[model samples]
Target: MVYRHLNEKDRFYIEQRLSEGDSLRSIARALGFSPSTISREIKRHTPIDFKGLYCHRLTSRCAQEKRANAKQGQAFRQISEEAKMLIHQRLSTHTSDQATLFRTNKLQ
Candidate 1:
């Protein structure tokens, strides 16, 4: 099975079904998702002040903010232009590929 993130439409559907007094299991079945998935989504996005109410618009915005924040610390940040120029200069002057590779790996 492939994993997929739910979109705004799915959130709207959930909100609609919830407002209609549908059971979580029924909503899950209708949406072709597990009941626990639906349950968790509601729990994750529902504000404490909302008193169990689920708002799709607010939930979507909250999810977007979380995703944006998560992208701050990526595994490999881009090298600056000056650093790239220095690397190019060093590599161009190096005679042995193996020695250059070893030095680069050591520096990292």
Candidate 2:
């Protein structure tokens, strides 16, 4: 089976099923996911203060924020400021002989 991240629609469906007092296993079966997946989703998104209530809108917002923050953190970790400056400097200068050769050959 292919792995994929749950989207807003799936979260909303989960919310709807939960509201109808459906069991996690039943919801997971209908959604073609594992019961553990449904259980984890509920556990992760349901606020501690809200008791058992699960809001799809809030869950989606939280997921988006987490994804954005993770992406930003990964980008920073992959490239340092010094490396960025070096790349900028190289780009601002004339093309190197190797680059010119590659470009010329690609045109042929």
Q: What are the per-residue Cα lDDT tens digits for candidate 2 across 42-79?
A: 88877898897999999888878877777664644655
Show the lowest summed lDDT stretch of 10 residues, model 1: 75-84
The parts of candidate 1 lying over 4 Å away from their true place are 74-104
Segments of candidate 2 deviating more than 4 angstroms:
75-108
* Winner by TM-score: 1
lDDT of 1 by residue, 56-87 (tens): 99999888888888888674466555545556
Question: What is the RMSD of candidate 1?
Answer: 6.5
Sliding window of 10 residues with minimal summed lDDT for model 2: 99-108
Q: In model 1, which residue pairs have backbone atoms overlapping below 3 Å?
A: none
